[model samples]
Target: MCGTANPCITLCAVLVGGIDGLENKLPLVAGDCQREVADLSAEERRGLRVTTKPHISIDESLREFQSDGALVRGLETPLVSAYVSIMEE
Candidate 1:
């Protein structure tokens, strides 16, 4: 989670997906990544979410980050700094 490039990007993506789930009131389901997504039946795929959405990247995550003011002040800066350090190299 730390010392990686754009770590928040990945975290944000996941949080965005979870936000989608919460917003949509989607039910939770267990999915196996070991199996191909296409191989899963519609029933098995229900409530499953991906880190990114179609036509959107980290933008959704940025929106999510912005909405939570308290969170952004403390947590995101360090992660963003790490990502910046990676880019500088």
Candidate 2:
């Protein structure tokens, strides 16, 4: 969560097409959620940021997920590293 004057950013790893049986469904859900948030005006959004990994999987371990070590890390990471990088901007 962000403070009053700062923007609120969220990092997510969208695990779609996994054994969870929600194959391809989570991406749609994520899209819908993003749309809802996008409906807000710029001022209302308050610099909101939403980062997602649409093709990730439930089978991925922490090391596997972060193997690329991209800004978009896995959920297992205590700190959403992407947030820190974006906030620095």
Candidate 3:
């Protein structure tokens, strides 16, 4: 895990990727997730390109928290991870 301690740092990012859902959860089996992956955000699509197995989908969600730079809501942790991007201000 990343260990950064800065009061001003306000972004929490989690890395979640796997094939066949690993031992964490079951594979999403409703809609054609991968077929539509090409149209997802650039970051979302990038995650799939690095996988070897082809039975998983990758997306991100945030926790129910607040910050000066960002806010995340995860009343219950979503099945997906979190993605954070910092832009020059």
Tell me, by lDDT, which candidate is best.
1
> TM-score for all predictions?
0.31, 0.19, 0.20
Better of 2 and 3 by lDDT: 2
lDDT of 2 at 8: 27
Candidate 3 lDDT, tens digit per residue, 1-89?
A: 12332323332322222322454486654333465543466555555543322223211112222231212232123312222322111
lDDT tens digits by residue: candidate 2, 5-45: 22222223433123223532444222223545535565445
Q: Each candidate's lDDT (Cα)?
A: 0.53, 0.37, 0.32
* Candidate 3 Cα outliers beyond 4 Å, as residue runs: 1-15, 33-85
Alpha carbon lDDT at 20, candidate 1 = 67
What is the Å distance of residue 82 in model 1 from its true position? 18
Candidate 1 residue-wise lDDT at 71 = 46
Arrange candidates by lDDT, descending: 1, 2, 3
Tell me the lDDT of candidate 1: 0.53
State the lDDT at 81 in candidate 3. Answer: 23
Score candidate 2 by TM-score against the native: 0.19
